[model samples]
Target: MKIPGSSLVRFPGNDPKLMLQMPSGGRQNTENSQLITAATVCLVVFGILAIVDGVYYHDIKYKLYQDKESILEHIYHTVRAVMFPIMMYCLFAHDFGGVLMIVGIGAVSIDFIMLIFDVKEEGRSRNRYGGLSNDEYMNHVFANTFHFVAIALILAAKPAAAWTIDPSFALGRPYPQVTAWLGSAFVAGGVIAALLHFWQWSQYFSRKVAQS
Candidate 1:
C-alpha cells in the first residue's frame, strides 16, 4: 500500500500530485540552499541534544538503558544514537539524491527494528514503571513533535532534491540505475515499521487488560 505521507515524497515524477513544482532560477536555488542550511543546523544541534537526553534520562536519571528490563531501550538507543547522525549527514552533505534514499531506507529499517525491541521492553516496563507519568508523556509529545516538524520542513523545502523520481532528473544528479531499487527498500521498510507498531500497540492494550 502506498503510504499516505510517502505520496508526498515518493518516487518524484510518478504523479503530478506527488511532484512539487520546482521554483526556477534564483528562487529554487535559494530555497533549496536555505533548506540545506536549516537541515544542517537542526540535525547537528537537535541530534546532539537527543543523544544527551538519552544519556541524562536513561543513564543518569533512571538508568533504564542499563536495566535488564529496559534492554530494548538500551539496544534501540545504542543503534539509533549511531545511525541518526549518519542519516542527517547524508542529507546535508550528499545533496539529497540517491544517498538520501539509501539513508532514508536505513532510518526506517532501524526504526522498525527498534519498535520490535520497544514492544518487548514496553511489556516489561508496564509491569515495573507503570506507564508514563503525565509529565513524561508531555515530554514525549514535545520531543517527537519537534522532531517531526524538522523532518517535514526538510522534505518540503527540497522535494525534488529529496526524492529519487524527479522530472528534473536532468538538473539534479540522479543516482545509478540501482537508485530505483532504493525506492522499493524505502517502501518495504515503511510497511514493516507500520506493521510492527500496529502489533506493538495491540499487545500493549492486551497487556493492560490483563493487568487491570
Candidate 2:
C-alpha cells in the first residue's frame, strides 16, 4: 500500500499504527541519555555545594563531610568525585587527576553500601531484576564493567604529551595506564558476557512483543 503521494509502499498487512508509534528503543535511549545528563548535572551542583558548604559550613552540621546520601539528598557523591578525574582525563594523560579517581570509586562504594541500608533490595528492585537468566546476569555484569572502564578511560589520560612525564604521576596514581588497561579488559570481558545475556533476553523480547 502506498503511504501517500510518494511511491513508497508496504505490504497490505503492514500496521500503520505500529509503524507510526515512536520506537521503543528510541524512547529508551533518549531517557537513558536524559538520566545520565541529569545525573551529571546534579552531581556537579552537589559538588559545588559541597565545596561551598565545606568552606562556609565548616562548623555546620550539614557540611558534606557529615552530609549523607538519600533519595532526597540529590547529592550523588560518586559522580561528583569521579567527574573531576574524568574531566582531567579528558584534559591530560597523567595521574594529576588521580585523587578524583580514587575518591570517586570510594564514593561509589560508600554510596552502594549506604544504598543497601537506605533501601530495600526487594519488591520493585527485586522484581526489576527477577526474570533474569544467566545471560541477563552476565550482560548486567559486563555492562557495568564496561561502565567502569569507560569512566576510567575518561579519568586516566594525562594532562600533557607522554614524551616527558612525571614519576610522581606514575605507579601510585588512580588513573595509571595499568588501571585503565585493567578497566578496559573488564569492559571487553563484560561485553562478551553481556552478549550471551542479550541472546537470552532476545527470546523474551520476541515472545513478549509478538511479531505477528
Q: Largest TM-score belongs to which candidate?
A: 1
Score candidate 1 by TM-score against the native: 0.52
Residue 98, candidate 1: alpha-carbon lDDT: 44
TM-scores of the models, in the given order?
0.52, 0.24
Candidate 2 Cα misplacement greater than 4 A, ranges: 1-122, 125-177, 209-212
Model 1 CA deviation exceeding 4 Å by range? 1-23, 33-45, 48-52, 112-120, 159-162, 165-212
- Listing every candidate in turn, what is its Cα RMSD in Å to the true structure after a full C-alpha superposition? 11.8, 23.6
Candidate 2 Cα lDDT to native: 0.36
Sequence-dependent TM-score of model 2: 0.24
lDDT of each: 0.49, 0.36
Model 2, residue 93: C-alpha shift (Å) = 12
lDDT (C-alpha) at residue 171 in model 2: 20
